[model samples]
Target: MRRAAFGLFGLLGIVGLLPQAHAAGPSDYSILIISRERLEVATSCEIGVYINDQLAGRLFQEQSTSFNLPPGELDVRLRYLPGQVPGCQPGIENQRSTRLQLAAGQINKYRIAVDQNGLTLIRAGLGY
Candidate 1:
């Protein structure tokens, strides 16, 4: 009887740990950055995604322009296309910065407007 009770307790412990183990999968949050203007202003722009200042990934205009970052607070920055002439306007350059606090299993959407005035940044998240 004692051995049976111990085994039952062990089984219950294993079951309880299963959920936690599965939770270790990739973060459930996604980052979507879009330019508000229809024109391809950022012809060769590079977007640097950082989580708490640690470089997560760099995306170019031609490749996966959007990114999926781990669920957490992030300080994202968009660097101008190298060697490209800077726009005269304040927000015209590709360099834009924004901060976001993301929750687990959430989808975060950001709209960045780029034009003669530089870049305007906005963020919204769902599924906190």
Candidate 2:
């Protein structure tokens, strides 16, 4: 019947669109990975990750977290958060933010590091 034939054609058309729908999914966002897997930051306090002035993630020693965000420039700041641990009190360190340029479908990796200035982010290899 013509109706059956038309239904089969409609199903084929829908199937043809599946690959395009999936292809657009990953290209819409970028991956941002922040890690504390190094010994550069010798502290017991949880470090707060601020994105656009909002607390987005917390990292401890030997730990890492990631986010899939839309491609663009992001304002990222790292600072020590006040916790039950002694000497981990807030407002005693710098609160400067770092600017990151992320492109669509790209992956960025950074590890926490410390310098004479204070806590900072250092770019690292993405092999891990």
Candidate 3:
């Protein structure tokens, strides 16, 4: 009877440890944070964030968004999206996609700003 009790306790202990063992697996994704809090972009239009050439999220002035993506090369594009405000129509401005290398368990930050050429994504510090 003592041997059976010991085996039962060992099985229970193993069951309790199962979840912890699974949680130790390597991380599979990275974090992407895009903010439009910069005043450099004076336009009030909503900006569309495209990931891998597909529209993923939209950002308005003073707004931000985040995504959990698999670690690898990502093609990010920003375009003006039409919104409630007038003059926020799409396809009027010329823009290009930016390629970013992301790693697992990493946090990448970017902010929308306007350069002499036009609207662009600027790499930003984690504090922002």
Candidate 4:
């Protein structure tokens, strides 16, 4: 019957649209930024955190911030900006960026350290 054929076509159209929608949008994920542990570094100064050269968060000593991001590649950096707040400001030292690939349903964590020169970022382990 024509009604049965039209219903099947409509179901096929809906099923086809699901894949296209899923492919176009990536799943949401999270990235956690932790301050690296060091006794010699100044704890009072809030270090600047950047993603893709943009100021994304501030890190205090032994503190952390988590950001929800889409699945993709991101440029992460840490800086020791002396007089900047929620802005990208950095000197020659301690200003570096590296690319990170993120997948869905994963929680990526990184650490930042500040010393005499400036800031240092490193991939961290989740201690059990």
Candidate 5:
């Protein structure tokens, strides 16, 4: 009878721990994109945001976009959409790409801009 009682208690204890054992921490990774370059506005073009070589967003000047991404190495690129505006061409000078190793529940922000030299992606903040 004592062995049976002890086994019951042990089984209950294990059952109580099942939730904790299976529970996972937050695994969401996010990226915030900001298009604040005067160049895009001046040229009246929408910027194409790419993730892993896929077009993710077409951001306008001063606009922002947020994405929930998988935690891993991501290739981020920004380019001008060719037909979005007049005088806006698909020039290599107006694009940028970067690889980021993101962790679970982490958020990163970036800004796209165009300078005299070329396009650039600048890290803007850590969250939101």
Candidate 6:
């Protein structure tokens, strides 16, 4: 009887730990931004993600390819090297800003345009 009780307690302990062990994985939300026009990808251009005006992360031109963010509301700013002319400057020179509300376990896509002033347009919707 003692051995059986010990084994039952061990099984319950393992079952309790299973949920915590399985909690680690990719973020619950994702976003993708693609350029609308074909331009030389700038090496210095960066995409900044802000949560409640706080700096969350920055993505370079290549890094802007995709994003995995927590489920919440975020203010996203895509800023290029300010004061530089497009195609003439050494880095990107544009800016685009938008807000997003992400739901848990949802993937969304936003088609963005980067011009002289920054992200000029954002087409956002659910993703497959």
- What are the C-alpha RMSDs, in order, of all predicted structures? 8.2, 4.9, 4.5, 6.4, 6.1, 6.9
Comparing candidate 1 with candidate 2, which one achieves the higher lDDT?
2
Question: TM-score of each candidate?
Answer: 0.44, 0.77, 0.75, 0.59, 0.64, 0.44
In candidate 4, list every pair of residues with a backbone clash.
none
Task: Tell me the lDDT of model 3 at 36.
Answer: 92
lDDT of 3 by residue, 1-128 (tens): 99999999999999887865445667689999999987778888888999998999998879999999999999998888888999777755766788999999899999988776666789999984
Question: Could you say which candidate leads in TM-score?
Answer: 2
Candidate 3 global lDDT: 0.88
Task: Give lDDT tens digits, candidate 1, residues 53-118.
Answer: 566555554443456656676666654434343542224445435777767655566555454655
- Residue 115, candidate 2: C-alpha displacement in angstroms: 1.0
Runs in model 5 lying further than 4 Å from the true structure: 1-27, 37-42, 92-96, 126-128
Q: Which segments of candidate 6 are over 4 A away from where they belong?
A: 1-27, 34-64, 82-96, 114-118, 124-128
Residue 47 lDDT in candidate 6: 45
Clashes of 3: 0
Model 2 C-alpha lDDT per residue in residues 1-128, reported as the tens digit of each score: 99999999999999887865434543578999999998888888999999999999998889999999999999999999888899888766776889999998899999999988888889999995
Residue 114 in model 1: shift from native, Å?
Answer: 3.7
User: Considering summed lDDT, which 10 consecutive residues are worst modelled in model 2?
Assistant: 19-28
User: Across residues 1-128, which tens digit of lDDT does each residue of candidate 5 receive?
Assistant: 99999999999999887865456866676554455643444656777878888998887776778888777898887777888457777755634477887777766776776667555677776442
The 10-residue segment with the lowest total lDDT in model 4: 83-92
lDDT of each: 0.54, 0.90, 0.88, 0.68, 0.71, 0.56
- Candidate 6 to truth, TM: 0.44
Measured with C-alpha atoms, the lDDT of residue 88 in candidate 5 is 78
Where does candidate 5 have its weakest 10-residue lDDT segment? 32-41
Better of 3 and 5 by lDDT: 3
For candidate 4, what's the RMSD?
6.4
Greater-lDDT candidate between 2 and 5: 2
